[model samples]
Target chain A: MKKLINKPEDFVRESLAGMAVAHRDLIKVNYEPTFVYRADAPLQGKVAIISGGGSGHEPMHSGFVGQGMLDAACPGEVFTSPTPDQMLAAAQQVDGGAGILYIIKNYSGDLMNFEMAVELAHLEGIRAVNILVDDDVAVKDSLYTQGRRGVGTTVLAEKICGAAADQGYDLHQLADLCRRVNQNGRSMGMALSSCTVPAKGTPTFALANDEIELGIGIHGEPGRNRISLKSGDEITELLAQTIINDTEYRRTVREWSEVKEKWVDLELLNKPLQKGDRLLAFVNSMGGTPIAELYLVYRKLAEICELEGLQIVRNLIGPYITSLDMQGCSITLLKLDDEMLRLWDAPVKTPSLRWGV
Target chain B: MKKLINKPEDFVRESLAGMAVAHRDLIKVNYEPTFVYRADAPLQGKVAIISGGGSGHEPMHSGFVGQGMLDAACPGEVFTSPTPDQMLAAAQQVDGGAGILYIIKNYSGDLMNFEMAVELAHLEGIRAVNILVDDDVAVKDSLYTQGRRGVGTTVLAEKICGAAADQGYDLHQLADLCRRVNQNGRSMGMALSSCTVPAKGTPTFALANDEIELGIGIHGEPGRNRISLKSGDEITELLAQTIINDTEYRRTVREWSEVKEKWVDLELLNKPLQKGDRLLAFVNSMGGTPIAELYLVYRKLAEICELEGLQIVRNLIGPYITSLDMQGCSITLLKLDDEMLRLWDAPVKTPSLRWGV
Candidate 1:
């Protein structure tokens, strides 16, 4: 594979090293049990926020760590979940006197590992809880997820929850806020081409010149369908329509109960979007797609939203979340409430997603 | 070629439409003679900064239009220079009582077209000046440029000079600062693969699976050499070394003279870089390269700069300027004076390259 990397094994470590140096003013890196934390972490009474997943989806958990976003981010190997030790260490490093909240994407490996980390943190006398995000509307279950895959909404959750944490939301309040965001947000992705992992040395999947995989997962997992390549506008309509017309999805999630002092399965459901709802539209590049193309996707998406009577109050476009070098894009629509909109506009000074500072 | 686009002819216009809708809060688009301008244009007496070029190097001229940056931007067809009418229209719309400063990259088509636009503006009694940027150390001449090709340093020049204009620099003073920035900056790029222009429907240039072109131009023009694939670290060393060790370069550039009422050629020379110089290091992706890989480039680049005794006080790492979907990267180092550094830290809220606001 033609990639700018030294060795497949050292890819994650070296990339993190580079990020640490480039953004030293905002974050610091911890090796061995790798995790990235804020430079001035452990604020006396603020609730600490943390998140993690595979390494390939950059600027996600790791790049979001800074002044008003994540207190710490645990980065696993490319497309692999971080081990419990790494997550636990990150929690220990960033936890203040108040509490800690772990923003977990709904992947099997991620759910299992972060659950273990929560238990480990409790054993060390730390109050830690997780808010699971399952906003992907493509498939009910996929290769690495038991339910809907957490996709673009994970980025929205990080920003909103981070701002809420800085706004003095306690651990429980922040967890509820995160869950509300996931319930209101939905996403669907497609891949024009597959990405090659540094270690794999080849594409994770393949497609003919005139074909694409619709509703593809971040890790190149099979989507709902593989079809012939279509125009940018057509593809955007398909993705946005799916998200807009999605039915109420019910799922069982595991959340920590402070009173019970243990995990409990809680049933939750998403509220179907309706006309006149305001949205925070997000158009994301899988990786290899250019920013100009993302604008094309955004252009079509805005039109679809206007037709559906969905008011787009805010929008974000670019490679905020991505799958290595895949050439594709994803559409995410988050129905925003007043509090969510306020927090979304709050100052955030992360390596990625910097504004209002 | 696989790309996310509509008809190739509508690519630039549609992309600009998307940008206008997405960043309506910050910028507005003018059709026919297409140009993007600040939402609050003609900002009283502030000298308006204007830039334009061929499309596809996104977030360059267009995305950089907003508060504390370009007051207006004119976008042309992909890899094709914008017409003088478009530039003149842009200047007319955003020209305050003070004057207009056109930031021109060193390309034959761009220079020629913008010079014509300046003459047209003079006929209309608009005070306009031009600042030329030719910071690439790659070669003395290329397909599109008579002398050195302007590359990554163009982004730095926009940010520094844009901030200066906001800080009350007159048109002539801002033009001088831009020239100083161009003289002290140098860049070099390499490509692992070629990008397909929408209009062309094929790769602009080609490279074998295991080969790369070093010092490649932003338009896929021929570079210094074609060689077998090398490790990312080795590639970084080659590019950074060339930029650091570049000798003094002397060239004559064209500028508009208010007194002469016409364009005049002026000889200019760049000073050789010295040890202990403080730099604002910029590592930019052509397009398709992932953020993780860019960090790898930045990692090696930082090491080399330290070894060369250069101090990096600030850095920008991402796809600020880009080819359509070229899989490669470029590195730029700009020696910073106290004024330039302070202005660099000033607030900018563009669609891309936003910070401190």
Candidate 2:
């Protein structure tokens, strides 16, 4: 692997150290139970928003930890889940009097570990709660639980929910806001090349010179199928059409019930994107893809949205969520209401994503 | 090359088209003689700042064309320099009644094309001037290039001078500011892997698994030497030491003499970086390198600066300047005076480099 790492074991720790030094004003890194917390976290009576998952998908969990976004982010080893201790430490570190909200992506390892973290935080009297994000339309069913994997919507949800939390939303209200954002968002991704995990020392998958993977997961997971190479416009239409045509999708996601004081299974249905829907279009690069190519994807996506009568009210185009050095792009269409629109446009100051400071 | 492009020939134009579509609120693209200019450009009596070069440097000259940075940017084909017409058209489009300042990097093709454009703009009776940025300390002598190649300092100069223009610096004043920035800055780069031009189906150079290219230039140029791969700290010191230790670099650069109406040679010398020097440290990724790895480089860089008694007062870390998908990074150190520091802190809002809204 032609990577700039000294050793696989030291990669994550050293990366976190490096991040701490580079953005010390914006964040402070806790090494032992690795978690990145805002430089001025534990705001007196504010709700703390926390998110955690595997590494590799950079500028996601960790880079987002700052003033207007995540209060703390727990990072695991590359493509591996963060241990519960890490999350517990994060919850303790950023717990303001109001409470904490865990934004957990729907991955087997992530869900289970965060579940334990929730329990541990409860034992510590931290009043921590969580909402599951499962917005990927690539997977057809939740039976395999390699269930609909969360992708680009996690980023959108982080920004919107973090903004809501900043604007005086309590733990319950912020959790509800996060759940709404997740339910209203859908994402589809594709890969032109697979990324190599530092530990594995090779690419996760191989593609022929003329092949491309459609509906790829962030961690180099195999997509629905490999198909012949296509134009940028064609690829955009394929992913956008799948997302646009997807009917209401129902899944059972567990959420912390504030009144019941226990985890409860809530059947959630993602409403179909109907005509005249105001949407926020996000075109994300899979690490290796450049911004110029992402604009191409947005060009075609804007055209498709116009044809399908979906009004794109706002847009973000860049490599916000990435799969380490993977060459591809993902498209996320979140049907936005006035409240969500305001939150999305709210000022955010983070290492990777920033605006309206 | 496994890129998300429809056809190799259509790469530059299509990418510009995509940029226009995505950033329509901020900028507009001029086709035929391709250039990207600010949507609200020629800001009534503001001295316009125009910069351009080869494509593949993702956000360098193109993504930086926005409100407070660049008035217009001309993108050439992949690694080739843009023609004189592109610059002339851009100058005309953005000439508000004040004048124009062209920020040209020190490359043969870019210098020549911009020189021609300067002459053409002068003929058109628009006061045009330029500042050549040649801060790359890698090249040993001008026997081939007057000594060093222009690298990271071009971006720094653009940003500082862009801010100066915004504050009503005339064409000559902005040009002088850009030249001072270029003079104060020094840079060195290394590559873990070579970048492939979209038109060229292979990497510009090859390296073994345990090898690296040191003192490399941005355009896939062969570096001063190749050596066995080392830890991130070792690599960082190797580059930082070069820029920090470089003293009294003398080179002859040609500048357009308005009174003489001809390109004239001027001997330029880069003064040394001394102890107690307050500076702006920029660690830029060459496209494919991720932010996590860059933090590792910065970690070592911060230590060396502390040890050397150099105070880094401001910093920028990311892939602002790039070479397609090259896996490597470059470090730039610009000794900052009070004026330069104030200009650097001035607000800039662009697709790539932005802060201080």
Candidate 3:
């Protein structure tokens, strides 16, 4: 309600305008289609990587567009999926001779839109592939999603897949690599407080002072259940244990097949994490959590990982992915192979995440 | 207060511990007389730069410790100045043979503790100097402060002067560079809400739903006055014009004189900002605000600068300096010369600020 935006309707458009001006050196905005692409677009022969979703999770799709990362990003209204036109335009704008890859998180709206965009791109003679990401361990079974929701691992996938694409991975290889990342990644989130949408001007949900929602989703949805507020270490332990002890989860999800040229409902399974598994532990804020607090969460997460015989080879702690103005955190564990590690370390020059560039 | 801390008393220490583990390769934390130093400390023959203050404004002193930034950072309790022992030990640990320079913000407790630490370091045969930063145009006249409070300018001073020290500037030269940065910068902040200190367990201040504090300090202190919530552009105009139209502000501030071997109260004056001034504009979040909102602030800031005939040659938009869980923003304008611009662009590899490294 106390947001610094002009109007609820103009929020997304204004944010895009501001982003275009702020990071003009790194990215360019196509306002008609509402997508952000690399400043130096159409890389001639490099595979184009595009991802997008609701606008509230900033620095995700838009901020990640630049050298060695996402080539383009389509943004929708807060908590709303982008139209197929926006995604299709973004793909066409950034695609080179190497083809295009769409990294779609397993949200019903995003999946349908990206799938439609892929079909439209096919008609345009652009080879487009989508690797569905369903890494969230929270939503056991709900109409909100087919199985688990895609949460924090989408960030890791974009970074790794972006690097691989930058290194000349073909479209099929890039899609396979993205699928591998999703299979190895798992995420769980909790909300200390709910966020108010600009239009609503009130919190999506409410809780008592001493209570919190443990398994909350990013869009201000109710979690598994409300619980008493606990200490940092206790909360960290709960999240880590849930993710670490998760059994092999099998679900029927949709993936785009280039040969079949249609969306196919395929059964996918997440392999249970094993002892001595190496990982990149990511602690993301749901917008309102501080870095200091995230580090505290990381401290407990590291302890739990060590006790479970898991090796945290790399770590990212910050508000990388978030729900608008929500006070909470999510823990993501991306099981890493040597190639994934190398790709992660590769140069990335996005607005939010940057290193070795 | 709803916070993600283990225990109120252990907040700073635990965050420091987490920072140590999170950025082990970039920084090292020393306990007892707590302070964070470069992992590879004592870069011999280099003038060591040290900055310390309350802990909530993270990534300012601690997160800025690496190859091209602060050599050491001392952290106090949340919103409380660090102890003399911490600063003293930090000065001793990172004092290369060239000397040690303390970047002290103009808060009474911080200035006093840092002054005592400088004297202590001097007794131990370390060449030490202190530069006071008081660029906040808010708090025009308060019994607590002489002229103004030091707010966002501290980040710019540490970064620009840190690069100068890395390039082998002597103690006196580095101190002078820091002083120049402080004199040329002006900042103003506004708070949409107040923050709760961990130990306090309550917000330091309060505001109505339709009200905003125009010039709130980082530690949750009142500013110029409270006003009805305004649009982003209107608020930006007020802050930008206040800083831009500020006339010569003269006050007696203390500085450590290596030659005199004493703290001296010297008259300092900030010249009125005028047309044709090239500035490095910084838009900082008050912790809870997201990158998207910060960009909105930056957008208005840029338009105002252009309208005022000032040029923003470089800009930084993020929550570099912060007040914990407070939703608001601050804008800093540091007039840049060629040398200052060169130093500003220098590579810094700290946990937060990193570019061209």
Quote the positional error of residue B57 for candidate 2 in Å: 0.6
Q: Quality of candidate 1's docking, in CAPRI categories?
A: high
Write the residue-wise lDDT of candidate 2 on A155-260 in tens digits.
9999998898889988888988899999999999999989999899888999998899999999999888899989888898999999999888888888778799
Estimate, for each residue in B157-252, the C-alpha lDDT of model 3 and write its tens digit: 989998999898998888889989999999999999998899988888989999999999998889899999988778888888889988888888
Worst lDDT window (10 residues) for model 2 chain A?
Answer: A138-147
Model 2 stretches with alpha carbons more than 4 Å out: B258-262
TM-score of chain B in each prediction = 0.98, 0.98, 0.98
Which sequence of candidate numbers ranks them by TM-score, best first? 1, 3, 2
Ranking by DockQ: 1, 3, 2
| TM-score of every candidate | 0.99, 0.98, 0.98
Which DockQ values do the candidates obtain, in the order shown?
A: 0.87, 0.64, 0.73
What does candidate 2 score on TM?
0.98
Model 2 CAPRI rating: medium
Candidate with maximal DockQ:
1
Best-performing candidate as measured by lDDT? 1
